[model samples]
Each structure stands twice: as structure tokens, then as C-alpha cells.
Target chain A: MADPDSNDTVISGVAPGISRSAPQSKEEVIVISHLYKSFGSNRVLQDFNLTLYKGQNIVVLGKSGSGKSVLIKCIIGLLRPDAGEIFVFGKNVPELNHFALDELRARIGFLFQSNALYDSMTVRDNLEFPLRRHWIQVTQAQVNDMVMEALEDVGLAHTVDMMPVELSGGMRKRIALARTLILKPDIILYDEPTTGLDPITGKEIIDLIVEIQNKYNTASLIISHDMNCVRLASDLVAVLIEGKCYALDTYDRLKSSTDPNVKPFFEQ
Target chain B: MATDTTLKKFLDETGRIAVFTGRFLNEWFRPRYEISEFFRQCYIIGYKSLPLIGLTGFIIGLVMTMQLRPSMVNYGVESQIPAIVGISIIREIGPIITALIFAGKIGSSIGAELGSMKVTEQIDAMEVSGTNPFKYLVVSRVLATTFMLPVLVLLSDCIALYGSYLGVNIKGITSWSLFWNKVFTNLIYADIFPAFIKTFFFGFIVGIIGCYKGYHSSKGTEGVGRSANSSVVVSSVLIFITDLLVVQVTDLIGYG
Candidate 1:
């Protein structure tokens, strides 16, 4: 059992046994090592480790309750892992205090399993929330431009004044992506972005995910069991089995993997 | 061991609530106040609750006055009705009734609103977006309730007095001026000030407890309803407990 109070460390390169090729750029954005999290007797994440490079998308594919959401929450500082270092931008996430974690979150966008848009606020207000929160110095005119630009990025510029409830499921997802994009964060964490949408809408969301990654050159960590999403969006796929990164490989290579634990995901 | 576990849970919950309160205090004085949202909450939590509080106050005053008339007549002090009603309404009944009404209306609203936000992950979204939900959601609301309750209580007290005047006029003849004169002649600084001061505490309790419940809401949509229900119940109980303490302190200090 790992010590619950262990401090985080900065490390280079992927851990041993993660055989996928590293990104061309050596700049690592987020690194998780020897992470352990548990709830009572149920140990959710045990000795899990992964390294996310800049401008890369690593989809952690897992079954429901496999701790994928826990991983994302820990990265974004929503949950504190019992042990291990989650280093994001040179600061350890669990070790960082509230103010520090909040500051870090500004630079990292997180899209929830739900769209999580303020239903009470207009679409314009949802997009403006991040800008006003982080850059209070920005003028109203500049904010309008940024809001429109983000909306345009998601191809929902017309829906800016509309309430979140008025939008369809796909539109809500797009608007949420736009809201996350308004901040122009360096990293974005998507928790099952394609879930609960029709196949067409899901594909559209995946396309948008890829497009945003290219346009912003942002490193994204997507947690999903959606095989289509894993196939389309992941620059590399990390198979999370029983609270550990069981395998790390490209989509094609993982599809051909012979291991039973890794085979089931590819078959789907 | 079961007792120990329950005690620990209670202590932990208390500590968490205290921390939540401390965090609000720390972030309160920081810059970039959400002025528009604060005013909106005041409009919603304060201005919107006046009708309900006023109606309750009116009924209480009228009923109290009518019931007291027979007793006063028995004691041969029927003329003292306005003075007695005025002191009771101003010193205690007015604030307590208005607070209970405010708690039901505003406390549940705050809890449900924030709890829905919590269950939907809107609060998390605000946090990840670099907004302080505590400052944006909690501070403005707590401040609004703290400031707004006293104003509502004051307004309710006046309305209750008018109701009492009407109640007095129903069975007997007393001029409006004379009724008001009788009511005011007994009203004093000690009675008004202590009652008025305690209302701020009432408002604070309602606001903080509501926010605390909603902000920490868990389980799901069911949690939202629980948060709203528990906020009203807890705040109402706390209001009475606070009133009891306030009365004791005031009495000890010679205000009684």
C-alpha cells in the first residue's frame, strides 16, 4: 500500500511497458504516477500511471466504474487521490492548495459528463463566464468578439443569445465545447463527450474534438468507453483495466492487440 | 464503536461547515464583486419575499389582538390593547414570523438553486472556469439575506401594527391617530434595537445554512430536494434557537 500523503514528483518519458511512440514534442503537460485512490474498501485507482504530452490526445478507455472519471476529476483537482503525484504544468495537483488549484484550472478546461452550462444564464453568458472570471481586465467589446469567435469555432454562432435548455443535445454539447474554448486553455479534459448522443451527433462531436485539438494545438485527455470516439479522436489509447494503465498504443495497434483485457475494447 | 463513528461524522460535518463559512469570509473582500448578481439575489430573496411575510404578519397581529381583547376586557384594561400588541409585534413576534417566512421562501430557493447547480455540475463548471462560485453564488446570497431580512422584518412590523389597529377598531371605537399614539408611546429604543439586531443574525443563519446545504449537496436530483427541505427545517430551528439565546442575553443585559 502506498503512503496516502506522498508528495508528487516531476518525471520524463512514459513509464516502462507503455510502448506507444511518444509525441514528437517532448514537452510533457500532465504526468500521473503511482496514483492510488479508494473509497472505503473499494480501491478505485491503484498504481495508475500515464504521461500526456503537449498537443496530444490520449483517450483512457475503460468500462463504467473503472475510475476513468476519477482520473479526470483528480487531474482537474476535483478529487484528491490518496497517493501519487499528478503533475500538471510543474505543480502537483493533490498537493496544491485551493487557490493554486483554482489558478491551474483556469489554464485547463474540463467538459463535464453533462454539458453543465448554467441553465439560468444565456448562451452568451456561458461563454463569457470563463473570460470574465480569468481576465477581468478584458473590455466588454473584446469579450463580445471572443464569445462570437468561440461560438463560430463550434459553428453555433447563432445560438449565442439562446438559453441552454432551448438547445438540442448535440447543440448543447457544441455550446459546451465553445464555452471551454472561450478560455483558450492549453489543456482540455473531456469526460465522455460523445455519450448519450445519437451516432451522427456523436461523430460530429468527435470531429469537433479533433478540429479543436488541431486548431488550438491543445493536449486533450478524453475519458470514454465510446469505441468510435477512441478510434477517431485518440492520438494514443490507454487501456485502463482494474485501476491501472494496462496498455498504451495507437488505435490501429490496439485494435490488433492479442491480450484478452485489451481485445474486448477493440472488438467493440 | 457505533457511537464513536456517529460522533466523528458529526464533528466532521461541523468542521466542514465551519470551513465553508471561513472560505466565504476570506473571499468576501476580494475585488470584482458580482454587483449585478448580488442585486438580483436581493430582488429575488428580499424584495420578492415581502408579500408573504406581510400577509403572515397581518394575520398574526389581527388574531393576537382579537384573542387578547377578551382577556383585556376581563382585566378591565381593554384600552391597553394597542400598547400590548405594539410591544409584542415590534419586540418579538414581528421579527420571528418574518424570519420563519423568509426561511421557508428564500432558504429553500437558495438550496434548490445551488443544489441543482451542484447535481448538474454547473458549480464545478464555474470553478474550472476560474470563477469563485463561493464569491459568485454564496457571498452575494448570504449578504443579501443578512441585509434584506431586517428590512423585511421592519416592514412587517409596521404592517402588523396596522392590522392590530384594524383589529382594535372591529369591536370598539379608537381613532387611527390615538391608536398609533398608544402603540408608539410604549415602543422604546431597547425593544426595537435588540429585536432589529437579532434579525441580522437570523438572516445570516438562513443564508449560510442554505448555501452550505446546497453547495455540498450529493447523491443526485433527490439530493436537491433534500437540500431544499433540510435548509428550511434547519434554518427554522436555528432561528428559534437563536431567538431563545438572544432573548436570554437581552434579559441579562437589562433590555427586558
Candidate 2:
């Protein structure tokens, strides 16, 4: 049996610019410490700790059923952990009430694996939904400008009148991203940003992800298994194995490692 | 042991539904209500359902009058046809049938719509976007159904009465005034008010059940279908059960 690879440095606590103790800096957007979650007998996440700093893209890479999605859900306050504190903007996620959570969510964007665009609503309505929902008072002209700007960010300005069902898969994904961008969230959580598309489309999405990060300077926590997404988009890669952060290091460093557990992923 | 577990599941579901209802009530009066979406839902759920309800009510009234004419003639109460049919239709058949039709149409639509949204992760997207989905989707729908059913029922009752008039005219000459006078004479406040009141509850039950089934839908695409199917069946059964309770209450209050 191979020992779990704990030799790699944990980027969240050990990264040069960030302090290990008392994470009170405005730079740290999300700090998930000692997170443990399970459904029934299946322990999905155990002692998972990660800190996302401002303007960083952290890709959590894992195999299928490795609790990657669960981790993202926990960070977004969709699923409460059995034991842990997920501090987002100095407020614990699980501890916040509904209104407070809503307030926090306005500042945090989430790109779902499914894109999750509203099929019944047109593209313009889809983008306007969050603005109207959060009660962000703006003139119609301002809303139109904001909507167009978000669409322009994703290079889909012409799709405003189109329904989601009318768009192709990659187009729909862009629309979903545009909707997320409309809010101008400080932190964005992406769940499998390039799952169901072809290589070219997937690469295009990855490029869009980088472009958005560069433009907005938002902290992004992306959960993915796609190696292309991992290699291209990650500022740092956190390897999740057996419900724990087995290795947290750069993609190149982990790829060059000879450790049996981490070696197989690189070999693939 | 099996029975105990089944009973426990039943209680758990009931409690969960109650909580869902409570949340709706709590969120209803909050700021940033989706008034535009509410009207849009009303248009879809209520206005679009008018033709179906009207057609069904008309057919019921026509067939019922034709079927009852023979019995009335044999009993020498043929002239009382308008009063008898009007009383039966207005007091019970009209509202119940209209509500059932509304339930089958709007209830299933709401269930399938929300179920698909849940499966597709649209609801989750709304949540992460700082949108109140329960308020935007569920409350608008519930309010639309609750307020619109009574209006639909009233319209259906009128169409049904008109159909009954056409049915009556097929046999002999009956003036419009005579027919309407007979109907008004037999129809009392007790019968009209209680029946009207019950349809609101019927609408409420349909909307809530559909919302509950759809909002909590799991297991992907299969779950969406199951949510729609179960929403129809559950709302139908609950409509009857609630109608029974309403009848009991109204009777106790001397409405019957």
C-alpha cells in the first residue's frame, strides 16, 4: 500500500504572500478549514482546508466521485458541512441566516456544471434576473448597458433576444457565464466549467475563464477533472484524494512527482 | 415494523410540506416581491386555462340537462329543470369540476416546470445569483392559482349555465329571463359563498402540492416526470379530501 502524499506544500496556508495564522486580510476571500461532510455512511469530504486569495484561480482536481462538487456546494452554502467553518468575507457561511447569505451570494458568482440557464426565459431576461432579484435599482438604460457589457464580456452580444433552447451547448454556457458576470461578483465558484463540450469549445471556455479572471481580478474556485482545464486555468492545483487534500501544489510539480498515488493521474 | 416506518415517512412528508407552506407565507410579504412575474404566471396558469374549463363546463351542463330531462318529465317536474340543474351545478359540480380541471392543467405544469428547473440546476443558479427562487417561482404560482381559480370557476359556472340554457331550448321555448330567474331563485348565499370559498382552498392545495413536488424533485429526469405525475395525483386526492372538509365545516356553520 502506498502512503498518502503529504510531502507537497499546501498552498492555502504556505503561499508566500498569505499569513498562516489569523487570516484576516482583505486578500483572502474564502477560507474553508477542517471541512467534513458525509451523506449517510459515505464520507465525501474530511478535513478539507483551502483558502482562496483575491485574483487567484484555484482548480480543485479530483477523480469522479471525489467530493469535488460537494466541496464547491459547501463553499457556496448550498450544503452545510457536518463539521467545519467556511469563512467568506469574514463571515462563516453555515452560520449566516438566509438574508445574510443572500447578501453574501450577491458578491459571489457560481457557474454550475449544467450551465443552468433558464430555458423559458430569453437571454436578456436571464441576465436581468439577478439584477431584479437582488433589488439593484437601476434605470432601464443602465440595465441594458450592464446586460450588453456582460454579454460583450462573453462575446455573445447578439444572443439577447434568443431563448436558451435556441443556443448550442457552448453558447448556452457563455450565456450562463454572462449571467454570472452581470452581478460582477467578487468571488466566482465554477463547477466543471468545461465538462460536456468538445476540446476546442472546452479550450474556448477555459480561455474565457482566464479572460474573465484577468478582467475582473476576482478570486475563482473551480472544481474540475478535465486535465486541460487544470493545466490551462489553474494558478494552483489542489489534488483531492480519499476525501482529503492529499496534495496541494502546482500542476507541473505534481506531474513530475514519482509518488504512486499522484503518479497515476499524471500518467493518464 | 414496516407499518411503523411507513407511518413515520407519512408524518415526515406532511411536516415537510407544512414547513414549505410556512416559508411561503413568511416570504410573501417581504420586499422585492416579483409582481411582474406574478402577473405573467397568472396569464399562463389562469388565462390560458380558460378555454379548457369553459369547454368542459359547457359539455357537463349540456349532457347533464339532457340526461335529467327524462327523470323530471316522468316526475312531472319538467318546468323545474332550470332550478334543479342550476342548484346542482352551482352548489357542487361547477366549482369542483372546474377546480379539478385547473389542477390537472396548471398543477402539472407548475410541477414539471419547477422539476425541470431543479434538475437542470436553474434553481441553484438563481440562488447563487442572489435571487429568491421560492419567492419568484413558488409564491407567484401559488398566488396566481389561489386568486385565479375563483375567477375561472365563476366564468365556468356562467358558461355551464349558458350551455344548460341551450340544452333546455333544444326541447321547447324557454325565455332567457325565465331560465335565469329560475336559477337565481334556487341559488342562495349559503350555497354560492361556501362553494366559492372552497375553490380558493382547492387552488391553494393544487399550487402548493405542485410547488412542493417540483421544488424537492430529485433523481434527475426521472424525478421530473415523477414530480409531475405525483403532483397531479396528490393534488387531485387532496382536492377531494379538502372538499369533504369544507362541506363539513360549511354544514356545521348552517350553510347546507
Candidate 3:
């Protein structure tokens, strides 16, 4: 699989300096160990361990229904795990109170699979929502500037006044990305960033992911099964299987992996 | 065995609702009050519901007066129409009808709204955005419905009384002062205060039930529909049950 397959490595080639083979530094931004989560009898994550470093984009690659979303939710303290510790920035996520969690969340951005844009709000209002929500004290003019800058980051400055409903699927996704960027979160979580878009739009989103990572220099934990996204956006790939980190390695290394389970993911 | 499971489900739902209400009570009074969202909900839940509430109240009042006219006239006491209709509308009919209408409209919308938000991960988005979804969505809405229903009921009562006056004028020439005087004379503090006070409870029941159903909504689009449907049904039934309980209490306390 690692025979320099031109198609697989195409997106990576386009965005130079994106696909890193290893962590650049030892600054562990997120250290999750022995994380076990289950809903009733369905154990989604079992003994999951992965570490994210500063300025790294680690994509947790898993098939559909492999508990990728569950893993992200636990890190943000949205769903308390059955047994585990998710340490983001040295503080255990589960141990934090509501106020503490909110404080932590301000520094961590999450882009939902569905975009989760406020349907009732205009794009401008949607972008402005998090500013007022986190009680970030900024004047109206600064808020506008921040909103524009975030929109500019996604190359969707023209869509500032449009409603989410009016935007196409890709535009909505971009708007959602803009909202996530508005917070300037230290660690961003992308949940299926390329799932619903067309292949072309998906590639655009992947390129944006790489671009955003480069410009903002923020660490990211992206959850996806899309190989295109996997190739273009990941610094290191963490393969999730049967509620555990089956493999955590580079794309090229994993492509060449002879493990029966790990080989199938690369073949596709 | 089926009945046993059904009973268990009932108890479970009730317990869950109680817990949900407890959370709301605990969170609503704390800091970072969403004043703008609260007012926005008031505009949506309260102001927007006026026309329907008014129309229903007017129609019912007109119909009730016309229906009672023949019976009062049978005993040559047709002049008691205003007094009878007034007392009944204020004490029982007005509040219940307005509340049921409210349950149908606001309850379903709130359910559908929060249910959709839950399904779409917007609720989670709000949370990850560092804003409490319960505080921003549920509390503001519940408070809006609780405060606004009373005002809507008061307006509904007034509109309904005017309808009754129109209905009275349809049959005989009763002056506005005489009609209003007779209506007010028949209504005591016991009737007005208890009826008015009970609406706050009705509003709260509608708000809390709608919020509960929507906030906890599961599945997908179908779940959103179920949330909307169940919120209306549950709040409507609870309103009647609460009315029965309140009426019995008032009777025991000599307010009835």
C-alpha cells in the first residue's frame, strides 16, 4: 500500500509541509490514558490511550459507529466516561466542575459533524454567538473585526450576512469552521469534517483544515474515516477499532503495516 | 405483568420530570442570567400567541353566553347571564382554555425546537461553546412561558368578556357599565386570586414539560416529532390534573 500510490499521496503533495511523520515537540497538550466508556452494555471506548502534542493534528481514524464521536465528547466533558481520565492541558476533564469545564472549553474548539449552526441565526449572529456566550468582554467594533477575521480565515467573508439555511452544504460547513475559529481555541476537535460534503467540497475542507492548522498553529484532534481527510490533514493517525486504539502511527508507516486489521483501512 | 411495566414506566417518567424540574430550579437562579434570550423567548412564546388565544377566548365566551341565555330565561332570570358567565370564565373556563391553547402552541414548538437542537448536536455545540444549553435554551424559555401565560390569560379573559358583552347585546340591550358591573360584583377575591394564581402553575407545567421532553429528546427527526407531540399531550393532561388538585385544595381552604 505504501508503493508511492499517487492518488493517496496527491492531497498531501498539494499542501506542502502538512503531513508530519512525528511530533515536533514533547509538549503534551492532551494526555488520555485508560479511558473506558460505555452506554449500558455497549462499550464504545475501552482502554483508549492517545496523546496530542502542541501544534499537532492527530486524526482518530475509525469506521462508522466505532465510537469516534464518543471519544471527542468525553474530552470536552459533554459525556462523563464510565472509567477514565482525559487530561487536557494538565487538568483532568472528568474531575472538573461545570465552571471549570466551561473555562477549559473556552480554550478547546469543537466542530460538530452536522455543523450544528444555529438555524434561527444569521451567519453574522452565528459567528458572534460564542463571543457573548463565553462572556468574552469585547466592544462591538472588536467583535465585528474578530468575526470578519474568522470568516476571512475560511475564505467566506461574503457569507457574513446570509442565514445558515441560505448557504449550501459546503458553505454551512465553512461557516461552522468560522465559528470554531472565532474562539481561537488552543485545541480544536473536528467531528467528521468531510462527511456530508461532495468529494470536491470535502477536499476543500481538508485543505482548509491544513491551512487553519498552519496559520493558527493550534493542536487538533480530528475524528474521521475519510481517507482523503486522513491523508491531507493528519500529522499522526490513531486507528480506532473495537473500542481501542488499535494502531497509532504515521500514514506512510500504517500504509506499509502488514497487520490484517490495519491493512484493510489503508487499502480503502 | 404488562400493567406492572406500564406502571413502572409511568413512575420512571414522573421521576425523571421531577429531576429535570429540580435541575431547572437549581440553575435558573444562579449567575450569568440570559436576559436578552429570556426577553426574546417572551416575545416568541407570549406575544406571538396572543391572536390565537384571543380568538379562542372570544369564540368560547360568545358561545357560552348564548348557550346559557335560554336556561336563565327559563326561570325569568335572563339578567343573570353576565354574572353567571363572568364567574365561570374567571374562575375556571378562562384560565383552563387559555392554558390548553398555550399548551398546544408553545409546548409543541418548544419541544420540537429543543428536540431538533438535541438531535443536531446544537445543544452540545452550545455546551462546548462554554454556554450552558439548559441555561440558555431551557431556563429562558421556561421563564418566558411561566411569566407570559399569566399575561396572555389576563388578556384572553378581557377579550372573552368583551365577546360575552357582544353576545349579550345580540339578544338584548344591556349597557356596558351594567354588564361590567354585574360581572365584577359576582367575582370575589377568592375567585379572581385563586384562578389567577393557578395560571402561573399552568404556565410552569407547560414550560417545564415542553423543556423536559425536548431537552431529553432522542432518536432523530422522528424523535423531534415525538417530543413536540408528547409535550403538548403531557402538558395538557397535567394542566387538568393540576387544576383538579388546586380546585380541591381551594375548596378545602374555603376559597371554592
Candidate 4:
């Protein structure tokens, strides 16, 4: 197995300034320790521990059915783990009451694998949904302004009135991204954002993910099977296999890793 | 041993249904409304189902008029045939038949769409995005169904009566004015209100059950099919159960 702390070194390469010194602050944004989750007899995640700082992009890589998506779901309080603790912004997820959970959710954003845009709603309405539901007190003009801004960021400013069905696959993903950015969430979780897209679109999506993260200075947890995306977007990489995560320093380090499972993944 | 197996199967099925229902209700009230998704659902559930409801309504009216013609003629009351068919079509048949068709089409569609989304990790996407999929998807759908179904039933009732009028005039001579007057005289506020009210419940059941089945669908292709099938069957059965209870209550209060 690769050293769990190896990925700490990779972080140094990307942001040299943040790497030079250790033990600077005690403000951990998200902390998952000893997490174990299962569906029936199938154990998907086990004893997974990770701590995320604010404004960091952590890409999770694993084969199909490796429980990478499950970890992100657990952090967002969507899927409760059978055992372990997930603390977001110093508050334990499981311990929080319903209102607290809602509050926690408001602070994070998610981009889905299939871009689960409500098929019935137009692009404009899709963006408005979260804002309205969160009761963000903005005037109609402000809402319109924000929606346009978000759409512009994704290069879909002209698609405001169009429905998801009318958009191509790449366009739908952009619209989903625009919707994700509408709330200006502090934390963003993406599940297979580049999956099923052409390589050009996939690269474009990866660039957008990086651009968005940098723009908002937000923490991101991305789950993907594409190694290229994992390498491009990650400040830290965690390879999940057999319900356990082997944290790595970088894609290069993971590729060169001597772990039997890690070797085959790179060779392929 | 066989009896015990049957009992166990019953308990297991009931438990699954109960859990599904509970989760749906829990998610239904939580904040986050998907207005676009809801409107899309309304288009499918309300507008799309109109053609089927209309066809069935027309057939129901035509058949009732034709069947009642002979019985009324034997009693020298052939002139009363239009009124009898009109009352039956509006008061009872229109709402129930429309609801059943709505359940078959809209209920199953909601169930399958949501179910597939759940299995495919789309719902999870909403949660991570700080959006409540439940409020956005489920509540809006339930609300749309609640309001739209009553309107559909009302439309179906009107169309059905027109169909009946046409059927009555095929062989016998009756003025449109006299036909409507007779139909309206036999009709009371009592009959219209209860029937209309029941449709809202029918819509609620269809929306809730379809959502419930889809939301809890297991992660696979098979889960989608199961969700769609269960939604139609369960909603259809619930509509009948609710109708029976409503009818009995109305009768007890002397509305019948």
C-alpha cells in the first residue's frame, strides 16, 4: 500500500508557499475519520480518514463501484455512514439537528454525474430553484443579475431560456455547473463531472472546475474515474479501493506507486 | 410452513412500502422547490394525460347513453336518458376515470424518472449542490398534481356530458337547451363538491406514491422498472380505496 501521507508532498508542488510551513492553523473545514459505510452486505467504504482545508481541491480516484461517490455523499449528509464521524466546519454532521443539516447544506454545492437538471424546467428556472428555496432575500433584478453572472461564467449566458432537453451533452453539463455555482457555496462536490463527455468537453469541464474553485476560493471534493481530470484538478489525490482510501501525493506519484492495485491502474 | 412464508412476504412488502412512504413525506416538506422540474412534471402529468382522459370520457358518455336507451324506452322514459347519463358521468365516472388514467400515465412516469435519477446518483448531486432534491422535486410535483387533477376532472366531466348529449340525439330528438336543463336539475352542489375534492386526494396519492417509489429505487436499471410499475399499481389501488371511503362518508351525511 502507498503511504497515506504521500499526497501531503504533492500538495507542496502546487502551492509552494502553503507547503513550506506546517502546523499553521487549527481550522479544519471538513474532517472524516474512521468512516465505514455499506449497502446491505456490500461494504463500500471502511475506515476512511481525511481532513480538508478551506480552498483545496481533492480529487478521489477509484474503479467503478469503489465507493468514491459514497464518501462525498457522506460528507454532504446525504448518505449517513454506518459508523464514523464527519465534521464540516467544526460541526459534526450526524449530531446536527435537521435545521443545522439544512444550514450545512446551504454552505456547499454539488455538480452531479449526469447533470440532473430537472427535465421540465428551463435553464433560468433551474438556477432560480436553490436561491428561492434557501430564501436568499434578493430582489428580482438581483436574482436576474446573479443568474446571468453564473450563466456567463459557464459560457452559457445565451441559454438562459432554453430547456435541458434542447442542450447537447456538453451544454447540459455546463448548465449543471452554472446551477451549482449559483448559490456561491463554500464547498463544492462533483461526481464524475467529465464522465461520458468527449475529450475536448471533458478537458473544458476540468478547466472550468479549476477556474470555479480558484474564483470562489472554495474547497472542492471531486469524484472521478478519469485519471486526466484527477491529475489536472487535484491539489491532493486519494485512491479508494476495496472500501479503503490510499491517499497519494499526486497522479505521478500514484502512477509510480508500488502498491499492486495502484500499479495496474496506471499501466491501464 | 406455506402460511408462514406468505405472512413473511406480506410483512416484508408492507415494511418496504411504509418506509418508502415515510421517506417521501419527510422529504416533501423540506425546503428546496424545483419549479422547473415541477412544471415539467405538470406538463406530463396534467397536459399530456388530457388526451387519454378525454378519449375515455367520450367513450364512457357514449356507452352509458347507448346502454340506458333501451331500459328507458321500455319504461316510456327515453327522454330522461340524457339527464341520467349526464349525472352519472359528471358526479362519479368523470373524476374516477380521469384519476385512474392520470395514475397510469403520470404516476408511472414520475416514479420511473425519479427512480432512475436516484439510482444514477442525480439526487445526490442536488444534495451536494446545497439544493434539496426532495423539496424541489417531490413537493412541487405533489402540489401540481393536487391542483391540476381537479381541473382535469372538471374538464373531463364537461367533455363527457357533451359526448353523452351527442349519443342521446343520435336516434331521438332532443333540444340542447332541454337536455342541459334536465341534467342540471338532477345535479346538486353536493355531488360536484365531493367528487371534485376526492380527485385532489387522488392526485396527491399518485404524486406521493410515484415519488416515493422512485426516490428509494435501488441502484440499477431494474430499479427503474420496479418503481414505475409499483407507482401505477399502488396509486390506482389507493384511488379506489379513497373513493370508497369518500362515497360512504357522503352517503352517511345524506348527500347520496
Top candidate when judged by lDDT against the true structure: 3
Q: How close to the true structure is residue A40 of candidate 3, measured as C-alpha lDDT?
A: 85
lDDT of 4 by residue, A1-268 (tens): 5554554222333332222222223356888899999999999998888877777777888889999888887887888899999989989997877668878887888888878887767999889977876668999999999999999999999999999899999999999999889989888889899999999999999888888876888888899888778778877677777787665456666667766767766676
Instruction: Please provide, for model 2 over B140-205, each residue's C-alpha lDDT reduced to its tens digit, 9 standing for 90 to 100.
Output: 999999999999999999999999999999997799999999999888899799999999999999
Cα lDDT tens digits, model 4, B2-119, are 9999999879877986785687677666544466767876876789878888888888887889888988999999988877887787778898899999998889888998998887
Write candidate 3's Cα lDDT for A1-268 as tens digits. Answer: 2232433221221112354332345788999999999988988999888888888888888888899999999999998998988999999999999889988988999999999999999999999998988889999999999999999999999999998889999999999999999989889999999998899999999999888887878899999889989888887788888898877767776778776667788898
**Candidate 1 local lDDT, B149-229, one digit each (tens):** 999999999999889999999999999999999998988989899999999999999999999999989999999999999
lDDT of 4: 0.82
- List the TM-score for candidate 2's chain B: 0.98
TM-score of each: 0.90, 0.94, 0.95, 0.83
State each model's CA lDDT, in order.
0.88, 0.88, 0.90, 0.82
Score candidate 3 by TM-score against the native. 0.95
Model 3 chain A: ten consecutive residues of lowest lDDT? A7-16
Error of 3 at B151 (Å): 1.0
Badly placed stretches (over 4 Å) of model 2 are A1-26, B1-5
Docking class of 2: medium
**Model 4 lDDT at residue A222:** 91
Stretches off by above 4 angstroms in model 3 are: A1-23
Clash pairs (backbone) in predicted model 4? A7-A248, A7-A249, A110-B128, A110-B129, B32-B136, B33-B136, B34-B136
